[model samples]
Target: MPNPDNSTPPIPSSVLILGSGVFGLSTALSLSTHPSFTHSTITLVDRSAFPAPDSASIDTSRIIRADYADPAYSALAAKASKHWRGEWGADGRYDEVGLCLVADSGKAEYVKKSLQNVQGLVKSGARQAGQGRAGKDSVQVLDTREEIERVMNTGGGSGESGYVNWASGWADAEAAMRYCRRKVEELGRVNFRKAEAKSLLYSGNKVIGVELVDGGRILADLTVVATGAWSGKLVDLRGIASATGQVLAYLDITQEEQDRLGKIPVLLNMSTGIFVIPPRDRVLKVARHAYGYSNPTRVPHPEKHSESMVVSLPRTKVDEPDQWIPREGELACRKALREMIPSLGDRPFSYTRICWYTDTPTGDWLITHHPCYEGLFLATGGSGHGFKFLPVIGDKIVDCILGKTPEEFRDKWSWPEKGKEDGVWTDDGSRGGKKGSVLDEEMRKGSRL
Candidate 1:
């Protein structure tokens, strides 16, 4: 354990953030916005070139709803929604389409809390609005099953359903991230670049820098590993975090169908694990969130989770090698849409791809300091729900680095949860390799419109 300079600075003079996705970029941008960090040397690194094509943050649209069973997210989303309204606005980037919460029986813990929270907030806002106070929180009950079916244009679209927070909508994720990166760069202290971080460069009990995949090393006073799904490989995250693959398909609906369902809100079928995003430019997105794919026996659960950056490559082979959408995923998605929006017809998907999620047990992000290494921080563990907090999550990261994170959320993001038992690869049987991958022939078709 030799020190590069045998120095340990109380505050980081230079900060290196790995990954350029939503979490990494947000932390970088938030650092630049800070009064002291404005002049600090900050570098944002990414494995891919500008706007990584396959990055989760590169999706065409991202849901901005705050309908979480946990009120922390709901309240935070309420705060960020205000900024999105004033800043992003309806300038072709953000929308206020809201999210339609549909459930199998409507009694699910997640769905029930969502409806109660949203409706309560909406009523509170309404009372305030009557007294000359105005806010965006708005909720509307679908009333009868007939109304839900009518909205979905199916005889039985959902058993229980409602719309939450008319202010909640979808945002162009890539556009927003690009905007944030530009703003961070304009601050003059932050630089964005393309480079893959191989591992952490440690000296004694402190992390001094990161080793690049290209044999070069970046030495920084503080290093933040925000690489998301790729995080476990570079560090011994153990079960605290691991990569799980999910599917996303882009479908092109007829103008008639688009007109009918375009203005409709996002479809969140909590039971069916299908999320049908709002139709944008006649292209609708369908995503499934449930049991996912992991590195089967190749990656077993680690006994302890920590800040150790040891490269333990997972050998478990993914069913879909070329990253194509599988037939299993396709059929499941179609079935969900068919049940939810029967009017859309049983058409084929235009484009589909598989994406990996860095999952955690509680679904809370891991934005805390490394237990074993000084000058090292863990800013990953998005767990598939990290995008919506893009606007403010970075600020909290700064707080954690500066020892200012609020008391309530610190434990949730910290170690020793109920069950950090992850890193095991569980297959969902969603791949239909018989036709090769989805990128092969029929899965993705160029838009003919």
Candidate 2:
């Protein structure tokens, strides 16, 4: 990847981002927004040109507002949602059509339990804030199918029913990404470069900068790896696994059919592990859970789920950053959707896309310092719930980089957990693993600079 034309002034500080995905762009946006970053040069390197709506070149349509079943994730999502609304202003780009989690009688029991759990957290948070009523109003558990239908119709402005409502929602991924990038550009110091990082440049144990694929080197005082699925290639040089997971989407219904289902809330069917989001455009975006993948070297499932990536891909390399288009066997997924909804059986697909997820072994986010590498930050292993936290993920990373102690994050996003005698060092580095070392070396290096 080439640097900006030499005719222009050099970047203030060489902040190099390896990937141009949502996470990478979000981090850059957060940094560019900081008061101290007024003159700090920030560069975002990616494989594609600036993305736009309807551009198949880059798929940024992965954002969601669904709260997770896990406490760590629910807390993270809650924070991210707040940040998103704050930054975007009222109706910035996301449509808060609310989220619907549909399930059968048996699966509804699980949904009910999960709703109870989320309600307890919300009430607890509000009570601490001195609010009188429990926030349980946000997590109503619908009993009758008619009640489910009424909630979906009235809540989402769709005027239709037959969908269960959950305490979650949807956002326009492309719009949100563009909003962040525009905010970054507003700073004028942040640089958006079209490049691909080849390797991390290191001075002994400390990382200095990144070398691009096309022979360009961008120096950085601090380097962060927000490269999502492709992070493996960048961090494995330091001996950490990136654990790639595959995700696929299908638009089985026609544009007319999708329009007929206008503004439907994002629906998550936990029983089948499928999510259907109704975008403004005449398209229904459906994605299945990343069950697991046989390539354990590239992916790890904490739930003991069966491997499903290879089974999901279409012969060609689908997991790569630039190469993801549906081929074969994707129709089977559409067929399954048709079986579930019945309305989708005859409708032709608008388009199908495949995406990748970077998973950690423990299921919790592996937001930690790179072992043995100073000045390098590793932000991967978000599992499948990374996008839901995009609004605050960048802020947290920036907080970490600024040396300010993020009290909540410090207690939550810890070192990866070790499973058995796998020899994988998963400590927060306080007990037996290496944690504080990276920060210490980074401080020392910065002082020398």
Candidate 3:
């Protein structure tokens, strides 16, 4: 551990990863299967079991949509969408309930381009023989607010135009992760440790390993921190990332209601910051796509970075007991749901969870080396939209570690100035400005946090 020169040690025979969420597991699995990574030992460490209950990735459902106002993200996600098809023997992993984009204007960048993008892919694929059944009847543009409401199976969207990628739908997120998990386990080169990482073990500016909560040491040539909302507590990301909770509501429906709500497409209204997923197993998931909560149960970072703080309020399943289903979050969700599904607004929520996103300055992900510590890298900041890209995000992280990241995504995800990015008029700074918070903002009294 005498790496005083601050230079990278060398080609790592072993990789020690913190957190077994999507990023951690996928990166390990991808590296283990890579021809170049032969014989390399990849160790994945987490505080809880795989698919931990509190992991944002452990939800019963998560939206896997290509609906985005940005073209770059849309293109990347659209290509990765195909892998959702029946992953690991689970049928309908990529359900066909349709991905409906509902926004205030038919001309919204996300609305217009997503329609063209999916439609183009379908038509182009149709021309080539031996194409899979992924894009048949894929895209449909709905003009007028009433039309959007009609497709949404409700009656409140009064001014919007959007489209539906009818071929696209939600993914059984928890199931897909388990599938990948089994595959990783089969590799045998990757080991899972149910231990919490207390801090990074460094040698003069070079990361030599990680220190576990139990006072254990894990030495590796390279250490990648893929911890989700808890990333800030483990390393120094320099304020580029923070943990913000997004709340989702699940409503229990009777068989009759399920028959009607089950077919509803993943309804996303970009203007409203909400989306409704298709009902499954007599339950429907609806969530606000904005920042929900910002309580830092972990030590606050002086620089306000994710890797520098550890969030302790979350468990393997949900947020802290006191943080569950705030009255304000529920009201906001109900209002948004009523806009698209009026019946859902009338029904009480069966349960709620705040999906913690390791949010960053840009809507893009962070998959780069740690500038402060050599031989250490980071691959988090899913920004609430990382699950759907499961098919390929891991390989990208490997590329980041190997210095092979494509130019398009390289700098966009690099560290940023949090104070500058989180300035006034800049909501979450991931997608757009004016993000919602979980504090039940007292807007009525002209008082804000």
Candidate 4:
């Protein structure tokens, strides 16, 4: 385990990054361009090709907002929003339709703090600089559900009160990921391999590289496990971080409906963790950002070969191709649709899936060197809010690798002390819904119905 002291480690000659999602891919891009790692050989390996179908990073749309209960993350997201307004967001990849964030009585605190943070950012002129016409006078407080509905421009809306940050928006997730992958390919410095990491290759206590599922070893001077939800399979995340599956249900709409709904702001209710990103390609998605279902499974311990441990890992369509969101999730999505957009309440979901997030108890990302392994670094723990930071997260991750973690995130992203798995649900205030829902149990219950 590495200490949290500001002591720089020598740049490795070869760096192997496992996983190609935001964390891994961004690190690869940053390492390929960073001067310190100019001579380093970077290899990115993932179970699937670029933009894995089951990855949380690949989707129809994702919210892009600077709104956060914490000022630090709000500021960071505001900085990232600048990039979303620029080249990274071009070519129909980003949509600046604004984000309407609301909350009920029970969850109003998070919304209140988030409003203050975004308002502060606006006051400090840290945000709204590059947002064009949409940037000016962006933060608008919605005192009631009616005001929220007005901002949403939809017939209905959730939450008792909230605010709308006109500067915020949404992005075409898959397109942005593809754009990122293409940029990495253009660099030509990284070697991208499509292979599943069976386990970490270790020499004593240090991770030397990764052993592929196919029984081949890829050695590197440093190994970065950025496998997102499946990181627990490679590293004993245990109570530090776990994989939780969030629900997403997409409904197909008529062209007329799309035209009408396309211009509406992205609506999110923090109380229920239900959100509606405006329609794209006549497909409207309703998702929950709650304390999601966990799929616990026993697997060989990465550090101890003879022992196996139960960890909450992702069981996506990749593993069960026909898998769908559990009935509880579907009903939640249905209810959200009825409350948020009454006109489409009866529409059937064209598709539904569980998106897995690498969640930490504090909702902070886990981005630091392994506490016990000298050559292993972890760049995971997205905690459901990592996608918007895509433009700047990589460089920040690189800084951590060089022992220069940002002052604000130094503690937030560091390797945390392990706790009991039963007590590890994220209490970030933003998360909603009942805790401790097991995926298998939920699926079995759904099957019974």
- Best-matching candidate per lDDT: 4
Tens digits of per-residue lDDT for model 3 on 86-113?
A: 4532565656577777666533665666
Return the TM-score for candidate 3, rounded to 2 decimals: 0.85
lDDT of 4 by residue, 19-119 (tens): 99999999988998999998899999999977799998999989999999999999999999999999999998998888889999766999999999988
Q: For model 1, how does the per-residue alpha-carbon lDDT over 1-449 read when each residue is reduced to its tens digit?
A: 11122233356789999988888888987898787675578988888897877677888888876676666666676666666665754465677666767666644557778767666655656211111113533565676666666654433465565544465777888888887777777877677778888778877788898888899889998888888877776666765766666778788977886777766667676666678777877898888875555543333222233423332132211443445555667777777777767766477777777777776755677777776678788888776777777888889878777766656676767653434344533222211122112222333442121
Worst 10 residues of 2 by lDDT: 428-437
- Between prediction 1 and prediction 3, the one with superior lDDT is 3
Q: Which stretches of candidate 4 lie over 4 Å from their true place?
A: 1-3, 129-136, 447-449
Q: Sorted on lDDT, highest at the top, how do the candidates line up?
A: 4, 3, 1, 2
lDDT for model 3 comes to: 0.68
Cα lDDT for residue 226, candidate 1? 85
- 10 residues in a row with least lDDT, candidate 3: 423-432
Instruction: Please give the clash total of every predicted structure, in order.
Output: 0, 7, 16, 2
Worst 10 residues of 4 by lDDT: 128-137
After TM-score superposition, what is the CA distance of residue 285 in candidate 1 from its true location, in Å? 1.0
Q: Which candidate is the best by TM-score?
A: 4
Give model 4's clash tally. 2
RMSD in order of candidates = 6.7, 12.5, 4.9, 1.5
Q: What would the per-residue lDDT of candidate 2 be over residues 74-168, giving only the tens digit for each residue? A: 56666666655556624635555556665655444445555555666677772122111134355555556566555545222211122332335
Estimate TM-scores for all models.
Answer: 0.83, 0.71, 0.85, 0.98
Better of 2 and 3 by lDDT: 3
